[model samples]
Target: MAPAHRDLADIIITDELAKRASEPPDYLREKLAFRDLADDMADNPKAVLPRLVRLAMEACGAESAGISLLEHEVREFRWFGLHGALAAFEGTRTPLDYSPCGVTLQQNAPVLMKHPETVYGWIRSAGISIPEVLLVPLHLRRPAEDGGAGTLWVVGSEPGFFSLEHVRVLTELAAFSSVAIRMIQAEEVVQAALQEQEQLTREMSHRIKNLLAITDGMLRLTARTATTKEELVAKMSGRFLALANANQLVRRPFAHDTISRVGLQQLMETILKPYERVSTKGLDVALGDHAINSMALVFHELATNAAKYGALSRDEGQVSVGWSIHDDRLEVTWNESGGPRVCQPETRGFGSTLIETTVRRHNGTIRYSWLDDGLTAAIILPLSSLAR
Candidate 1:
């Protein structure tokens, strides 16, 4: 069996941490100097992490400065942020167990190493020759099982280059970094929650408007049929029930389905089921949601007019509704037969106007013919309108 590894504290001190700890008064003064700045930087890790490394390099007059975060899953130390001579090394990874930063993490204290390339093989591979280094562990408020987080370090090109004062400065910076990281994390959580709430609000508003539009169309169609107040009330009640059923199906949430498109066959059956006592058939072509929505209003107007004056007015009357795709355009035909003699009205009514307007809105064309037996209506919708 391999021998157990020794604790980091037992291997290397070199009088660096002890020398800094000996001067408590000077260290306390340094902490007091940056207390306000630390408070101000606590909410911005992006700004604070980079500034901390820059300040460490400036204050200690070091050749390079950086912070390495411990990636537990890979057992590597990635340069989270950097400044000064080694700025290009940001995001580079080093072996966690065999570097000076690892020693600082394991000891949970500051460590000073002289001629670190002798111990860390990555330094030699990268052609970096740091004569001395100072690293301070940043213990974040994480679960103990995570083994905490990272280290802040400064490097020098000459032996015994980093003094006790440099260690004190880096330790103070690491403390501020821990608070900044926590604050940034909390801010991200709050921002995400707010975004989710906004999306839900927008969806609710859209659904309300859709319900209102459907209600208005039903009211207009029902008004055209009823001559007396009692007839109006009875017709409205039945139409409202049909509207409710169609709305329920259209508004249902489904994976990979959006509000802009609905099933063509399903919509027709929902709206026409009330008038099915008279033979009604045909709507087989596949169309998109936008086309379906516009067509729903058109069909509602056509069906309402037929029930009042056309084929659906009599028990023996029949209606045929179907669509065919031809050369990048959809042609939908509505035929009514077996009722009273058909004649064109002297003036255009709301139902006729509604059908025309709805078809035009979807970039489609409509034609009406008052034949001797029945009314024939044809609508042509271009496929380009439904591409999206």
Candidate 2:
């Protein structure tokens, strides 16, 4: 007799499982429309979930309705949002293996329990008299491989208070809840991407403004060094062009930081390229990315002076720039020849002062020799300043 009764019970449970697995006609139609409202709810889960719980309570005529999200790692269901009599239970946790919501999730259907305390003894121990509870599995719109979301439920204090009508209403709410949870997760990803883009925009803007300011300062200093209008324009134009080229090198795609190392050969070639009339040669050398603007400015001043009165001013003139690392120092030589006679300036000007300042800033030294044919300048920088 006992085996017969157990066999009959097993058959009843199988039939129940089959019924739960099948979707109701109304639910199928309702789920089709969930996609349209998903985007709207994605951005505002706090506002949407509360209203959803409220609507669920009103639609089902239940005393309480709430959404519980499964925290898989902790094996618990966390009450994300709630409405009606159980509103105070928000943020509370219940074991996934022991709660009514857990049973509904496991069965992948609506679980209607009479005297839930009979199974979840804590409900009785806590003195919370919830006699009847209805939970609907809130399956997320995730791929079937992900096992979907958790459960949403409506509980009442009176026995036999909930019916099939309540299940229908809660199922609809559960569908909506699943989409809402997915939307919230997507919204977070979108928000994070937007924040990163905003930060990059601000960083680029600041870098551009800083480059412009530096160019302006260079223009003013160039003005102080020129003896005539032609010299002023020429000097300013060369310095500006050099500054522009340096800015271009540092503005490579997705460069987040301000400081970038300019290669020694690359830097010299870029600065000298505009001097079309002069011949320029560069030798490869290792240089770190530090004080790039200052170093560029120093080379710009030297190149400008060459174009005006040194090697670059004459058709037969030529300039050779090279650097080598020696005993923890970087030695850069700028040798010029095949031009008109060279003479040292009588007074210290912006170009000379700028060169001095740049060298000092990098803890380096520069020496200029005004030869009979052209000027030769040698700059020595500490290896520490040139180490990447």
- Per TM-score, the best of the predicted structures is 1
Clashing pairs in 2: 140-149, 261-289
Candidate 1 residue-wise lDDT, 238-338, digit = tens: 55565565556544243222443455566777777778643444545554544555666677768888888988898888888777779988787888888
lDDT score for residue 127 of model 2: 54
lDDT of 2 by residue, 94-132 (tens): 898877777777677677665565445666566565656
> How many collisions between residues are there in candidate 2?
2
State model 2's lDDT: 0.70
Residue 210 in candidate 2, Cα distance off native in Å: 4.0
Clashes of each: 2, 2
The window of 10 residues in a row where model 2 has the poorest summed lDDT is 1-10
Name the weakest run of 10 consecutive residues (lDDT summed) in model 1: 1-10
